[model samples]
Target chain A: MAFDGDQLSALAAVVHEGSFDAAAQRLHVTPSAVSQRIKALEQQVGRVLVLRTRPCRPTDDGEVLVRLAGQMELLGRDAMAQLVPAPGASRAAPSSRRLPVAVNDDSMSTWFPAAVADLPADVLLDLRREDQELSADLLRDGTVMAAVTADPRAVQGCRVRRLGAMRYLAVAAPDRRDRWFADGLGAEVFAAAPLLAFNREDGLQERFVASVVGRRTTTPHVHYVPSQSAFVGLVEAGLGWGMVPEVAAAPLISAGALVEIRAGRHLDVPLYWQHWALRTPTLDDLTERVVRAAAKALRPVRRHGPPSTAG
Target chain B: MAFDGDQLSALAAVVHEGSFDAAAQRLHVTPSAVSQRIKALEQQVGRVLVLRTRPCRPTDDGEVLVRLAGQMELLGRDAMAQLVPAPGASRAAPSSRRLPVAVNDDSMSTWFPAAVADLPADVLLDLRREDQELSADLLRDGTVMAAVTADPRAVQGCRVRRLGAMRYLAVAAPDRRDRWFADGLGAEVFAAAPLLAFNREDGLQERFVASVVGRRTTTPHVHYVPSQSAFVGLVEAGLGWGMVPEVAAAPLISAGALVEIRAGRHLDVPLYWQHWALRTPTLDDLTERVVRAAAKALRPVRRHGPPSTAG
Candidate 1:
């Protein structure tokens, strides 16, 4: 059976607006009209789609339709952009489209915004900052069209591409370096010193310690500072040493604000771009821009095969 | 049948350090000694306490021991402070203590730091900034000893106290207000105009819309700027109208950078202070400071009845 696009759109509107009355206003129709369309659609599907509560929520069945509606909207916008005359060519104002993308906090603070700047002005970004390890979940749940995630595996019906790696260097203030590691950078010194972590999920420091000590080591005194800028600032102010992103640490190291705690030791976190497999102009453009920018700013992935196979 | 304090401390150290060897170093004992203590503790409890992972994690049983260790540490410090003379009086260095507290992003950006400044110098603050709606979850999981949350319900083993409400006003750039809302703050204007949201979880704008239109309304165009400062800046730049915290909107309103879309129509999010029920001196001091600061910065919650029993 053919599903009506208008009914699907109405369902999406109600879910997004959180009520039938609001959806009606947005659709430029009466509240009863909005209610009737939703009822007809539900009857056709023989399934309850939405829970009519304050700030309405989608039932599991409703979510399936909402995802389809969003994907359809994105595709429709792409087709319109290609078919319509360029903005300056006509008196009619060009319409903008919203593109939701999930990104990790570290990437957001470091290099993601610059990549977004390269997208067409007609594409409005609805950026969601999530943990890298969890951003892929957003894609799986249909909360975002694409995500920058640490997980290399693609979600069902999605495609994944390697986006290089973000490198982190163990860094500390000069005085902290002197006070904690005066003897040398060794496991013993690392065990005794206080450390700073982004949060409980931050395991970079522990990993570094494991690499140095040849085993997992406990950090007795840890300070958790969750903000990206503030985390770096606390490190600079001599609060404690931590793993600083190379992008944020390079300038600080040169300016003498931070010093590498251990030379020739760092962690590289591989990142991947995951997006819906649907081939659309906007998603293609976004993917191209992000890949190009990441190639320049991040360390390229080391190929396990010959150079000819690498790209 | 009593649990030894040293073994419990060793278990906590391993969990915190993420490795037995590191815990040993922090405890000033041999790695074998640390291992033996943990083994004895596990044997005594007849449950697997610590998972031997790269960064040691607590099993369900281990988590109980970890929580107990943390509580014991807090209580021990309070006892020492009361029994001993001030550090400077006898020329002996005072040992510092770590205190982990969860706070909402809005509070962290506004008045929460002032409350922290009142904490004793010997107290180290490990501040975890979580969404107001989710901060209480941290307390439930024993990730933090206290939290500033929007939820009035107390987590198990925690005490809850109301701390006024954070007021938010619907605001937009002056030019955007003139262009889109010139007709007035009606449903038609809201449906057509772009809006700003902190993230997908932020429903303040939707809530405000429901309040104004007297029903839930769909916002077709939205820009999600996750950072608090950036979210406000985008609204000021005419990107969209959004619900800005009264604390953040006041100065912008005075500077003429922003205009209120609906005057006198605002949303007040009631906030509550939740902390472990343990009545230690440090926790009491923190509670007092937070309560005092909230009174000065947030809108006072109106009393619903006679003041005789009011807290």
Candidate 2:
């Protein structure tokens, strides 16, 4: 059975706007019209698509439809951009398209925006700053069209392309490094030294320590600095040692503001661009920009995923 | 009936850790012991306190106990700091205390960290970077012990103290200002010029526009840059105009990279410190530092809150 574009658009709007009245305003229709469309769509599917909550949410079955709607929206916009006369060629102004994307904090602060700066002026970026480990969840839930994620595993109904690895170094303020690791790096030093973390959920420090110690050793003292820039600032301020992205840490190391706690120990997190399987012009354009940015900012990855394969 | 300290700690741990097993690891107790403590507390209150989800969450009833638990924990920590000898004096290292606080991103990027820097070394800050307009919600729900918030009205069981105002200026890159506002400030220009917002939920741009236009006016184009530093960076890159905090804008303004759209037309967002009414030494010390930092960094407020009060 064919899904009516109007009904799918109404469903996307209701879920996106979070209310029937708001959806109606966006669609330039009455609230009753939006409600009728939702009801008719539900009847056609023979399933309850939305949970009529304060902020309307899609049910499990509704998510599948929302993903389809999002894909169609992108394809439609791509088609229009190709067919419509360029701006200033005609009086008809092309409608702006919003592209929702998920990005991690480090990339957002560093290279991601550079890539975004190159996108077409008409595309509105709705960037969600999520953890690299969890960004794929946004794609799975249909909250975002694409994501810069670490997992490298393809989410169901999505395609994954390997971006280069973001290399991290265990660095500390010169004074902090001298004071904490005076004797040399050991399990005791790793356990006692106060660590700077992005947040409690951030596991980079733990993984870094584990790589050196050969076991998971909980550092007794931790300072949670949640901002990417500030996290680096705190490390430079001699507050604690932390895993600084190599791209961000290089300048400080050169300036003698920071020093690696142990020489040559590092973590290289492989990043991947995961997007809907559909090949729309906008998505493909964005993916290209993201991949290009990663190529410049990140180290070349030896292998992409956990289940290793020959390069 | 008296509340058990152990049970309260268990509740806070489980809720904060998001799983009983994780809570058990933090508390150094068996999962069954944590479960039993929760059950006993529920029986004592004769109310269901926790929802048994994958990550256990507090029920509405649970929040009350959690807040009480948080307050009690602070008081206990303060007492120990007073009663115990200094760290070097005894073999027993005083157990570290975790103080959770909510701070807005702009403040967190600028002055908030300075206040936190001066805090006693023993206090581990778990800072939640939330919007100033909504930071108070964290206090209301027992998620944070204190917040640097826009709302001066106290949350239930909390006391409010004014922390001066963060002044904001509508600024654009030199080229951007010359290009976009060459026609001078008017309703049409305001509606058509691209604006930078923290996010879709951010209403600062709309509010700034309304102040100029005498009513709410939607700007046709908006760029959502979520990072505080990156938001300013985008404005400096001549991407769009935005309401920049004066502290950050001052440097850029002096550097000739940014220019104000209209001279002397600024927004002063008065900030306040809201914390649990129970004044522990740690909380008081933190509050004093916050007030001092604000006094130095923020503009003096003419009055605080929606319902104005005589200074």
Candidate 3:
């Protein structure tokens, strides 16, 4: 079935701007006009697409339409970029095309900002911070066009490219290391020494501990720190020991502010750039930038088997 | 009717750990034992408290019990601190008492970490990051024991203390200012200049623009960069003009990398510390630390009238 571009855009704007009035301002239309378009679209779909909350949210049915609208808007901008500009003249900035992408906090704090800083003035980014292991879910549900994910397997209808592996070292402040694990990574140390976690969803520490102990065990004393920079800061402050990214930990470790809890024992989490398998220029450009950034910031991934597969 | 402490702890642990098996490991009990305790608690309350999701979540009723459990645990630790420690002897660390609090990103990246870093080794922190304006919802819903909030008005059953005001300046890279507003702040600037936002929920830029134009108007071109440091970095990269905290912007401004779009017309977001009125020692200690940090980092709030109030 064919849908009107204006109606789809209106529906997308309402969900994006969070209210009918705000959507009107965004689309340069009246609130009544936005309301009429939404109502008409709902009538055509025979399902209520939006929940009239304080910040309007897309219902499950609405999510499908929102994804469709976002794709159309991206493609339309690409078309404009190609068709409107004359040879040797600068391309007109396609200012309003928002590209939604999901990335983990660690990368967000480290190398991701560089990729974003290099974007053309025309394309705006809508970034969502999610755990690396879980970011693929955003792509599956069409909430984002691209994601930085830990899982090599991609969501259906998406393409995945290996973005190398992020290496984490188990480290602690010098004083904390002396006080807690003076002897070594003994079994008793796991139960006694304080450990830091990014959040409940963070399993990096657990994986590191499991590698050492050969079993999944919970640390009785743990601090749940959510921010990327703060997690490293806490470890540097002698609060707890945690798995720190090698790139972030190297300078601190050399400076005597931090020491490796166990030398040469590390966790390398493989990362992938997963995005919708469409030939959109913006998405393609982003993928190239992400792959380049990953190459610079992360350790190269080692593959053992045949590589090419549908994501 | 009196609620069992063991049952309450079990319920809280299950919600925090996100699974019955994980909660069992935390409580040092069998999974069946954890299940029985939850079932008994539900039967006594005559309501379903926990939803059996992949990561178990609290129902509205469960949230009430979770808050109760958290408060009781804090009080229990406070009592133990007094009773268990003798004069001139080192106090035993209460290792597992997780203190959940809500803080905004700007504060979290700056002064807030100092407060957390100073926390006694025993007290663990579970921080929830929300916008200063919306953080009070976590307090109202009993999801957080305390919050750094924008609103002076306190949540129900909570006490409010005037922390201070966080001042924000309208800033852009020197080059960006030269290109976009060569003539200075004009009616056409708001429509033509690209603006930076923390996210969709971030209204600081809009507020700044409205203040300049003497009315609310949309910036047609905008980029939403969510990270605190990244937002400022983008402004320095000549991507767009944005409302940046004065503390963060000052260094860049002095270095001539960033310039004020409009000087002396800054927005001051008055912040407050709101927490449950109950006299728990850890909460009291945390409040003092928060107040001290705010005093050091933010400008003092100017009171108008009627200083004392409930949150």
**Model 1 lDDT per residue over A79-114, tens place:** 888888444311222466778888877787777766
Candidate ranking under DockQ, highest first, comes to 2, 3, 1
Arrange candidates by TM-score, descending: 2, 3, 1
Q: What is the lDDT of residue B208 in candidate 2?
A: 79
Give the distance in Å from residue B239's predicted Cα in candidate 3 to where it truly belongs: 2.0
Off by over 4 Å in 2: A19-32, A53-55, A88-94, A304-311, B19-25, B53-55, B88-94, B304-311
TM-score of model number 2, chain B: 0.93
Better of 2 and 3 by DockQ: 2
Q: What lDDT is reached at residue B72 by model 1?
A: 82
Best by TM-score: 2
Q: Pick the candidate with the highest DockQ.
A: 2
Ranking by lDDT: 2, 3, 1
DockQ of each candidate, alpha-carbon based = 0.15, 0.38, 0.32
> What shift in Å separates residue A244 of candidate 1 from its native position after superposition?
2.0
What are the chain A TM-scores of the candidates, in order? 0.86, 0.92, 0.86
lDDT of 2 at A258: 93
Which 10-residue window in model 2 chain A sums to the lowest lDDT?
A85-94
lDDT for each candidate structure: 0.78, 0.81, 0.79
